[model samples]
Every structure is written in structure tokens, then in C-alpha cells.
Target chain A: MIRSLAELKAQAKELGPRRCVVAAAADPVTLQALSSAQKEGIAKGVLCGPADKISQAASKAGVSLDGFEIKDCPDEEAAIVAVEEVRASGDFLLKGHLPTSSFLGAVLDKEKGLRTGRVLSHIAILEPASLGRLLLVSDGGMNIAPDLVTKLDIINNAIEVAHSLGIEKPKVALLAAVEAVNPKMAETLAWAQITQMAARKQIAGALVDGPLALDLAVSEEAVKIKGVKSDVAGKADVLIVHDIAVGNIFAKGLIYLGGAKACGIVAGAARPVVMLSRADDAETKLNSIALGAVASVV
Target chain B: MIRSLAELKAQAKELGPRRCVVAAAADPVTLQALSSAQKEGIAKGVLCGPADKISQAASKAGVSLDGFEIKDCPDEEAAIVAVEEVRASGDFLLKGHLPTSSFLGAVLDKEKGLRTGRVLSHIAILEPASLGRLLLVSDGGMNIAPDLVTKLDIINNAIEVAHSLGIEKPKVALLAAVEAVNPKMAETLAWAQITQMAARKQIAGALVDGPLALDLAVSEEAVKIKGVKSDVAGKADVLIVHDIAVGNIFAKGLIYLGGAKACGIVAGAARPVVMLSRADDAETKLNSIALGAVASVV
Candidate 1:
């Protein structure tokens, strides 16, 4: 199991550099992050944007664009070309300097898009300084309010990421406010149904339980004190939140309040898509690129 | 502003004792707790239960029954008598060794109950070792799944408690998973509506904002980093949750995970009701009783 981001970065180094196609890669911070990842030998990407401007931005960020492919294209055409690069032969896709809508549209394009007929979801990996393992939180960046089927797909996407990272079995806790399936709390009801479904082998490769409170999902002492009984009571590797708001808030809470390091990627696509927050520190962005390298294989 | 449970205890000492009626007070722990309060001059109460048994239990618990009123009623009638005691005296009510359902039934009785046509809600006060002031979380124990109106009442009930606690303008944060009023997230929508209500002075005596994630409610650094602008951001005294599950889980999370000391009481009744959990430590229970004393006047 990958315990820390340090270990995750080590794993990415072992996986070596991948052909990471950067969609509209003109943003200075994005170019700098990609340059750092390239220097670390975890990734070598094709920057699909106006080449001269990309170089200028890279120069402004004090990063060299040497030893990297620069595809000369405008922003709108660059996104399509980068998506095609990843769809044709590259290992992963990285959205850079493009409007989120434009980038996502190019990836979701019907005929030329990198679609695998699965609902795409974002997975955030947080490594708390104290917790010995990485905590995976999902759908925080996509799918505003997913239904049962969509939630199932979201869980599957996370499980696949776990599998890609070499976890044979990841304990997934579907987070609600509580563990009981109360008639009034819809998250509990949904978790109960999904837990039953996972029990019946509908969602495989992960040990799933819920609707667990945040403490019950993460703290061993809470399980004993609350007298809660479950396989994934306090040792959850992944927390599948009910909706995008919950997922986003929870991931940010852990980062901002808990002082944890975080990285994020979009899953359920044909390839891993590196997507880091704009204000994220360099280590976080590099770890995201490392995650992209690791999740690129599957 | 109450800084700590110890401070709350000191405040209770300064307020002097009020008439507090305990229903079915034959249980040893209940009598012991009440006896200690009585000794501190923070409570004067009628123990409504069988006399001889109550005396025996009190003796076993090393508590004296001197200088107090005792109603010789069986378990079934003890709850009713206790409710009537509060109704007639207009003081506070405390649940003793009686079953929760029975005690609550008596409080909700149509003709003789302590109901004031307002929905009863539980308010949990947490004073973290690090926080400068108390955090109030409401409706965790009562109102399983409240509607928008019930939520508004819950907020009002919390506001009433804040007013009694001498907070002229308490900052209230209606907690959701995110700060945005996203149409897809129902919790955010509800918080937005209630926030507008608070803004319109429909719910007075509080500076209200939402939907705020937990981090934004308590952490000033998070507010600055997120660049969120609101009156209740980063300095909330009261947190009005979406439903019972959210409130209960959050309070427990702070207690079990964040190492916060918590005390809870039932508010929005004719008289404040002490309803601490049985597993609560003695100090927490006493603080809850103190909270009941403070909120009873409002």
C-alpha cells in the first residue's frame, strides 16, 4: 500500500516518465509544474499551445521548455489536438491554461474525444502528516449531484484508481452524517442501498461500508467509543462522499484545516487527467503529476 | 462569551440556584449529579420518584436528600409530575432515570406539557481547548429531519440561547458542505434561503451566512485563503446544521476527533431541559445542567 505522498512519488519514479499531453499549456504556473515533473523524470509532455508564447510563459516562470515537444496551435485548437494526442498514443492528458469548459468539452467530444463510456469523476488524494496512508476523496471536481447509478460509477472509478496504485483491496467508506439508514437522511439511505449492493458483489475490488460519520470513517477510537460494528469502521482508504459539494468541502477542509498535502486527478476516462488547484503548492502539483504517471497505466 | 466548561461552571455558580425538576430521579447517577449541583448552589430541584427507593439510591451514590423536595410518584407518573413541576414553577426540567420516550412524552403532552407551540431542538455547546469561545451546534438530538421552517425555528432557538448567554450579536453559520449556493446541492440551497431570511431580519439577533464548510466557520486562515466575504465567515458562534445527522455527526466528530469538550441541552421548550448522554463525563453533565439554567430564562 502507498502510505505517504513520498511513497507515491517514489512509485511514480519507478513507473518512469510518461507521454503527458498538455492541453492548451500556456499558463506559466502550469508550465513550471510540468517542467518540475519533467525534471524529476516522472513525466515528459507535449505542450499543445502557441509554441512561442508557451516558451515566453515558461521563461517568465524561470522554467526551460527544452527537451519537450511544443505543438504549435491556438488555445481552442490546442485542446482538441492535445486530446487527440492522448487518445492516439499518449499515456495521459493534462489540462493547462484552457477554460475548464473548453478542455472538458474537447475530452468529451463524441467522435474524437477520449471516452470509455464511463462517467468521469475527480479523485483527490490527501496525505495527512499523521495518517500513515493516503486518503482518497472523489467526485469533488465533477458531477454536481449524482444519483445512485452515478455514485456507483464514482465508487468504481475510485476503486480503479486504488487498483492502479497496486492496492489489492481498498476499504471504502461511503460518508454520510451517520451510519444508520435513516428515512430522512438521504445520504444514509443511499449509502445503505449501495453498501448492500457492494455486499452482493455488485461493486468489487473494494471493501465498502457506510453511511459513516467523518470520525467513524477515520478514527479507530471513535469506533470503539461509539460501539460501531463494521468492516470498514475506522480504517477507510477511500471516502466516497454523497455529492460534489461534500467532496469538495471535505477535501479542502482536510487540506486547509488539517494542514494536509493534496493532489487531484480525473478518473474513469481512458487515461488519467492531471488536474491540480491553481493555488496548490508545488509539491502538490508535482504529486498530482506523479499521480497522473501512476494512474496512466490503467 | 463562555470560554470553557470550567468558566461555564463558574458562571452557573454566579447565577445562583434555580428550581430544577428532575423526573424519575431514583437512579443513583442522576441523584449523585443533581446532589452535587445542589451542594454547589447551582440547582434546587424536586426529585419525582418513589421516596424510599430514591433515598436508598441516593444513599448508595453517597448523596444526601437534605433540603430538597421529593414527589412520591411511580415511574409512570414521575415524568408527568416533573413536567407539571416545571410548568407550574416556570423554571427548568431535567430528565433523571426515566426512559427517554416517557420523559419526552410528558414534555410534549397537549394540555399539561411544557410545549410552547415551538419545536424543541437540542443545542450542543463545544469548547475546544484551543478555541477562544464556545461553538453552538443545534438540532442534533431532536427534529430528525426538519423542513426549512423547522430549520428556521432551530436557528431562532439557537439565537435565543445566544442572547441568554449575553451575546448581543452572535454570528451564525448555516453549515453545508460548501459555501456556494449551488442549485444542484439541496443543503446549499436551504442554507442560501435561510441566509437570506437572516439577512432580511426575518431571523433577528444574529449575523448569518452560508453555506459555509466547517473550515470557513472556524478558521480565519481558511476564509482568507478561499477569499470568501461574509459576516459569519471564520468567526461563527453558532452553527445551524442541515439536519439531525449533520449536527449529530459534526458534534461527535469535534468531540471524538478534535478533542473538544461538549455539553448539550434541549432548547425551544417553555423551560430549558438537561439531556446529557449517559456516557458523558461528570463535568460535561454539569455543564449541560448549567446550560439548561442559562437558557431556561430565555
Candidate 2:
């Protein structure tokens, strides 16, 4: 199994030099990250945007695009062209230098989008400084307040990503404020329902448990202290939250406060979609590209 | 200002040996922590439980009750007796080994409780390993899903605690999944309303901003990258989450994964109420007592 980001990058390098098609790839940071990924043999870049803008971005970032393939397109048509290119032959898609709504608009386009009949969710893979293994937090960036069906899709997407990382059967923990199902807390009730469904094989390919507090979901000491009996307690591979706020804050807390290294990608699409944030560091962008390369292979 | 947990403990010791009344003070961990705090001159404990159980717990934990004042009472009456004692003479109240509901029942009792005409909220004071200063997170363990008015009270309560910790004009950040006030996300709308309310002096004693993501709330780098113009963007003294799930997960994530030192107490009562979890370490328990001692002074 890929235990850390280092191992993940190494695995991606071994399996790759996969084609990563970038939509509106005229951002200096994106050029720099893709250039580094290409140099490391993780992915080969197919930069899709206006040729002049791509060249300007590469020069500004001090990056060499000798081994890259450039596709010239107008600013408004960049996302559509990139999506069509990926659907025709390219491996995965990456967003760069564009509004999120515009880029997502192209991806969700009815006739020419990467639709898989499943709800699209964002998965963040984190290598917390305190934990030896990689942890996955789901739907933090994509789903605002996911309902029960959407949460199921989010879990499935996370499990798929874990499988690509070589985890045979990921343990999924549904996180809430407390372990027990409180009548007033609606999330707890939803989690309890999901847990029951998982037990009955309605959710397959993972050991799923629910209504766990953050501590019990990740800490063995907390599990023992609380006397919680669950397969996922203290050893969860994926944490599924009810809403975007919880997942986003939880994942970002680990990264900003815990010194965790993180990379994120959107799943449930026909192809892996790497969405880079301007605030993300260079290392995170490269790691995300590597994650996309690996997730695309399967 | 107290920048770290060590500094917090020192300040507590300097101002204290304040009287702390313990409800159901028969838990081994509680006895041990209180003994250490007493020795450190943080608090003078008044153990309010059956003398026999207290003695047994102290001996089991290798603690001495030499300087502690024992108030022998049945388990059922321990919380009420402790509340009454604190109302009469003690500086603060500590929950030792009782169910949280029972202990809070006494604190929230209409006639005999420590009512201050404000909604009670739990504030977790964290000394994150990555940050040099203390960060306060509110309503994580008390209010489940608070409305706009309750959130205002929660923010006010946190501001009071920040003041007690010597932070003048604390900067409060209302946390959300994103910085923009999207109409689709109800929490973001509420946060925007709260921000406006703070601007109008409806919520006083702090500089408050809303709809900030976790990174933008704490990281100057994120603020610089996003170009967010706000006083509380990068220097938030207090983080106000929308619900218990978000606050709980965020705080515990920092503690378990970020290696933060935390101690929590319920604010808005007449006296600070220290509520330590069983899973907390010895140092955390002691720090909580110290926090109670300091927060009780004002």
C-alpha cells in the first residue's frame, strides 16, 4: 500500500508519465507544478489554452515546456476543449487559471462532459505529521451539505481513491459531534441509517461505521477510553462528514495546524479532475497531480 | 499576553490558588490532576462527593488530599452542593466524575444554578503546535445547532474568555466552508448577518468578521493569496463555528492530528465551569483547572 505521499508519488512515477490535460493552463503556479511533475516522470503535460498565454506563464514561472503538447484555444473555450480532449484520448483533467464555475460548467455539460451518472465529490488525501498512513477526507470542496444519497456517493468515491492507492478495503467512518444518535442532531440520525445500510451490504467493498466523534474515529486511545466497538474506530482510512464546512475545516486544520501534507482531487467523474487552489503550496500542487495520475489509471 | 499553554499555566499560578469546587470529585484522573494543580498553586480544591469514594479514588491514583477541603455528600446531591458552594464562596466549578447531563442540569437549574441571562457555550482554548498564540474555538461541546441569536451569545462568551486571557479587543472569525456569502449555503448567510451585526455593535467587545475558510481565518499566506480584506482574516483570536459538529471536529482534529494542547470550559455562567473529558491527558486536565482558575477571576 502507498503509506505516505512520498510512496504515492513514487508509485505514480512508476505507473506513469500519464497524459494530464490542463484547461486554461496559463497560471504560473500551474505551469511550475506541471513542469516539476513532468521532470519527475509522474505526468506528461498537455497544456490547453491560448498559446501566447501558456508561453508567457511558462516563461514567468521559469519552466521549460520542451516535452509538453500545447493545444491553442480561446479563453472561453478552454475548458470545453480540454474536456473533449480528455474524453477522446487524454488520461485526466486539470483546472488552471479559470473561474471554478466555468470549469465545472464544461465538465458537467450534457453532451460533452465527463459524466459517470454519480454525484461528483472532492477527496482530499492527507499525510498528517502524526499519523504514519495517508488519510482521506471527502466532499470538502464539492458538496455543500450533502444528503444521505450524496454522502453514499462521496464514500464510494473515497473508497475508489483508496483502492487506487492500494488499500484493499478501506474503513469508512461517518463523523459527527458524538458517537450515539441524538434525536436533535439530524446528522447523527442520518449516520445511523448509513451505518445500518453498510452492515447490510447496501454499501459494499468497505467496512463502514457511523456517528463517531473525531477523536474516536482516529485515536485508538479514545476508542478504548470510550469503549467504542467498531471496525473503523481508531483506524479509519476515510472520514465522511455530513457537510462541507466540517470536512473542509477538519482537513484544513490537519494541514495548517497539524503540519499535514495534502493533495486533493475531484472523483465520481468519468476521469480524475485535479483542481488546484491558488493558496496551495508548490508541493501540494505536484502531489495532487501525482494523485490524479494514479487515480486515472484505474 | 499568554502565548502558549506554559504561559497560561504560569499566569494562572500567579493569580491563583483560587477556590475550585468539584462536583462528584471521586474520579482517579480528576483527583490526580487536582492534586497537581493544588501543588502548583493553581487552584485550592473543594472536593464535593462522598468522602469514602474520594479517599478510595485518591489512594488509587497515588494522590494526597492534604490541602483539599472535602465536602462529604451523596452522589446524587454532589452537583447541587458544588454549585451552591461555588455560588456562596468558591471561584469556579469543576465536573469530576458525574454524567455531563447531570452536572449541567445543576448548572442550568432555574433558581439554584449559575444563570447569567446569557446562553451557555463551551470554549476550547488551544495552544496549537504550529501557532505561537492561543486560539479559542467556541460552542463545540455545548450548543448543538445554534441559531443566529445563540451564535451571537456564543461569540460574546468567547470574547469574554479572550478578555480574561488578556487579549484586548479579540478578533473573532465566523468560520465557514468558503469566504463568500453564498445564498445556497445557509450558514454563509447567517455568518454575513452576524458580521453586519458585529459591525453595528450588536455584538460588542471584539472585532468580528465572517464567512472565512479555515486557512483564511488563521494563515496570513492564505489571506495574501486570496486578497481578502478583513481585520480578522489572519489574526483570529476566536473561531466561531456554525454548529457543534464543525466545532467539535475542528478542535479535536487539531488536538489529535495537529498535536495541540487544549482545555475547555463552559462560558456564560456566573462562574467558569471546567469540564474535562476522560480521554484527556493529565496535563490537559491540569491545564483545564488552571483555565478555570484564570477565567473565574473576571
At residue A166, what lDDT does model 1 achieve? 79
Quantify all predictions' global Cα lDDT against the true fold: 0.83, 0.93
Clash counts for the predictions, in order: 0, 1
Q: Output the number of the lDDT-best candidate.
A: 2
> Which residue pairs collide in model 2, if any?
A258-B258
Best by TM-score, which number? 2
Q: After superposition, how far is residue A218 of candidate 2 from its true place, in Å?
A: 1.2
> At residue A182, what lDDT does model 1 achieve?
84
Note the residue pairs that clash in candidate 1. Answer: none
Q: How close is chain A of candidate 2 to the true chain A, as a TM-score?
A: 0.98
What lDDT does candidate 1 reach at residue B145?
A: 71
- Over B174-237, each residue of candidate 2 has an lDDT whose tens digit, in order, gives 9999999999999999999999988888887899999999999999998999999999998998
lDDT of 2 by residue, A151-186 (tens): 889999999999999999999999998999999999
Residue-level lDDT for A199 in candidate 2: 87
- In order of appearance, the predictions have TM-scores of 0.86, 0.98
